[model samples]
Target: MAGMPTPHVSPGLYEVFLAVARAGSFTAAARVLGYTQSAVSRQIQALEDETGAALFERLPRGVRLSEAGRVLLPHAEAVRDRLARARAELAALRTLDGGLLRLGAFSSAGAALVPRAQAVFRARHPGVVVTRVEGPSVKHLGLVAAGEEDLAVVSPAADRPAPEGVTLHHLLDEPMLVALDRGHPYAGRRDVRLAELADEEWIVGNERLEDTLFRAAPAAGPRPRTGLMAQDWIAKLGAVAAGLGVTLVPALAASSVRPDVALVTIHPDDVPYRGIFAATPPAPTVAATAFLGLLRETAQELTPATGR
Candidate 1:
């Protein structure tokens, strides 16, 4: 006896079988599939040859399903339904209709950049769920590199390079601002030089001068005395409000500071602007790309054409 037909069938063969079964005739299935009647018959023949079972019985008027065809109907329908659902899910991801976008950012960016971008993203793609994590820029960068975060808003350190497996898109260079008491003489000035504030006590977030925001300032002049250390923004601003000392604030965060504190732009030559970026993996998700575009728009709105 001849060897049995190898059990091999393509999705297209099942599709033709389904069409012919529904239409009850090769000619009708051809019309539904936009293929010639001979082509439909050839597909059905191939499917039967592969399955080693006759799937249809010819009739004087049309055709009827064989016992094997009836047995296979539901399985073919299931495969067809599964493929359709898979296509829909892929489409949703492309269109941002559904998916999750994981985000990370440093403290200051949470003040405006990240929040504004997140608001716009949520408004546009309500189906996409966005979750955010806040911490230091280095931590966010590491999370992004490790694939825990889809994207991150970070002010990259000048001396340190981004971790491997990460790509950085520069958003802006934001100038540092001095957060002083309302009663401070420099409060009303358009800008102030660091040399003028050398005698003043500085409120810093880190105990080490190199780790604080002031590290960005040129090292030529005498370092301001950092007498107070307050890791929390509330404590730092509270100290500044009471005229205890002044702390450096990123320009991105200037809008969210307390009204009792004054924000004075530091001279460009004194403390250089910090470089802000959106960090992502080599292949970012569609939602991450959309959120990054929104971040760029918000960054532009916050900075003047002349540059901050």
Candidate 2:
């Protein structure tokens, strides 16, 4: 009689039992496992000793699991499946062919870079799963630092760079573009200056986001009035298209601009650019590294170094 007990039970012992149970004979189990019949018998005996239960009943013709064996059968099968899964996951993690990539991104990057990276990643590694969270870059930085996320596409404030234990891979500098209704007086121009739009109302996703822009443009004098505050890129762009006000659109988000709105570059000195980075643990997993490379490629496509 075997029972769960004092010393550790080797997974091998249960494996042997499962083989014997499946084959219904020690000799058959030995043949399948490439072990001698005596070896199979000894391993099963050891399992029975450890568990204090008879895992099989012997008849003149063959063998079958006893009452105790039936109880342990499912446990053995589960352990076998678990080990198989563990091996597969480890292999995936090593090769970047499978596993999950937990990614965090700020609003603009989520609107473009992260999705582009995810699509390319899935094409190359279909078995890998990607989960994403959207928030301010500062929040994403904390998630990466805490190991809650594998990595993030962040636009950390210049003075507040990567946190302790995390590293930043520079992606690109996204110059801010002004989103204005096509009907605005300066809409026909390819570029505009911050000083020109100084008195114009500003549209923003939220007050908090507006603060960042306002802080940077204090040199322009009074903070631009907030005529309308929309909660998402689409809403903000829509409002601008309706002649509500203007909002800043990152270069990363330029492609998603509304058809009726113009994304006009600002004068170089007044143009505020946010640095994009791939923040990760110093030694990221294969999946994270692979995805990071794809993100860089996507960033290049969005903001080419050629400066075109």
Candidate 3:
């Protein structure tokens, strides 16, 4: 003998079935659902065809569930309950009143921008949990593409622009500052031209950041004489304080520099600047949207170009 076929139930059919089961009559279900009685009967017929069993017993006054419907009742109720819970969860996430926001950022943003935004967002929406991961810009961008991070704070290298499957929204253009020892010859100057520092030994935070110096260097200018390779901001500042070498600093970080080191603006027609971007997938999550707004707000609020 052939076996019975599996039923293919849609969410719509479940609603109709549940209405008819509760109302105990096609006319009453139709009235409750704003459908005609004939429409309700047709829907029941289609459901019966799909399930390969009669779910309602026709009576003179009303209808009652057949044995098949009684068996399906629990499963139908379970699906309805699960869907309701899912909708509620999604609503909470959309409201930003409660949910998890996974974010990634490069070192500089983690130090200043990310923290500032997180503090504001937490105060505004205490139920939302914001998590952060710090790494290179490329790594953060990749995480955003892979859906591991809802959004990322990245300063993408010019040559290696944003990759496919990710959108990088420009937030700000951050100027580079030269960190010098307080006693350096040009430390007292308000702003020193990059040309004046061509002869000084440099302390680079990261080898990759070497390009920042060159971009502001004069065409015929000699390359910076680099000595120490430090990755952390404090260490780079410490090196400059000890007179090991001067290092480049971004405006976002100038406020954090130690008093031992002075941050000087580079004067030139073309000042080297890094672009900060909020990276997201084509469709961003609700929490991502809220956090991105906070990131941009923090950037604009703290931007030296914007006045502080």
Candidate 4:
């Protein structure tokens, strides 16, 4: 009886087996494969040796498949077809003709920077699929580091360092603006100093003073009164529109704020500009690299003077 077949056979052996079965003769298969008849005979013998079964029966006229060869025909064909499909899909990804792009961005970036870049990327590579998620910059940064996201737009906290395996590409430095009700005393001012608002009630997203927009500024005088806390942008802006309190807005979000609210630039000396960055892995995928370029282009259009 034949010994047990080899457990780990090469895919090339399967290809040779298939060719011989199709041509029905060693000479014909060798001619098709650009090999000599002896080479084809040796290949078939090696395959039979590994399989421990006669894959073909020798006859006076030609060769014919045996029981073992008949049984493996469909499996060999399936492997060939599957490998061909994989090669085509891989080629498509290389050419930007097809693939998935996983993107993440902070809330403010979703307003214009990310969306505009996404639009251009879609136009340029229609066959590529794109998915976007919005959340805090820290969360996006972690996701990028974990390889869950291909690229992310973030405004990382100056105090916190990015997780391992993540690299940040600076996109721009965004100035901060103060949102006040239309009827406020300084609403019409083109710009204002942070000290000027010391007496005014401040609307904040978090209770911790360090987490709010004022974090960029130094602890010069008394902390501003943050009596009201509204986590949602809509609630925060609503409070400002109702003359309840003022909230700081990133320049990227100025256009998206309530029309009734006034936006005045904060003197750079009071609060430094925040850095906007694209987080990526050490070696980004082709789709991710393309999208990064689009992000830079969109940032330029959004902030020509401040964009890096």
TM-score of 4: 0.90
Per-prediction backbone clash count: 0, 7, 0, 0
Q: Give the candidates in order of TM-score, highest first.
A: 4, 1, 2, 3
Regions of candidate 2 where Cα sits further than 4 Å from its true position: 1-4, 19-42, 54-74, 204-209, 220-222, 227-235, 305-308
- What is the lDDT, from 0 to 100, of the residue 24 in candidate 4? 98
Per-prediction TM-score: 0.81, 0.81, 0.78, 0.90
Error of 4 at 149 (Å): 1.9
What local lDDT score does residue 216 receive in model 4, on the 0 to 100 scale? 59
Q: Summarize candidate 1's per-residue lDDT along 1-308 as a digit string, tens digits.
A: 75875756699998999999999999999999999999998999988888778999999877899999999999999999999999998899999999899999988889988998899999999999899998888888889888999999988788886789999999988887888899999989989888888888888775232354456555754476767888888999999999998877778878888899998897888776788899999899999999999999998888883223
Name the best candidate (by TM-score). Answer: 4
lDDT of 2 by residue, 1-308 (tens): 54445578999887888899999999999999999999999999988887787888989987988999999999899999999999998997788777889999987787778898899999999888889998888888888888889999988887664588789999998877788898889987868877888888887666354566667777774476666777777788888888888888777777767688877886667646778899998888788999899998988787762122
Off by over 4 Å in 3: 1-3, 36-38, 54-67, 89-102, 122-131, 142-150, 159-162, 165-167, 215-225, 281-291, 305-308
Q: For residues 75-124, write the lDDT of model 4, one tens digit per residue.
A: 99999889889999999999999999999998888988889899999999
lDDT of each: 0.86, 0.82, 0.82, 0.85
Q: Candidate 3: which pairs clash?
A: none
Q: For model 2, what is the alpha-carbon lDDT of residue 256?
A: 68
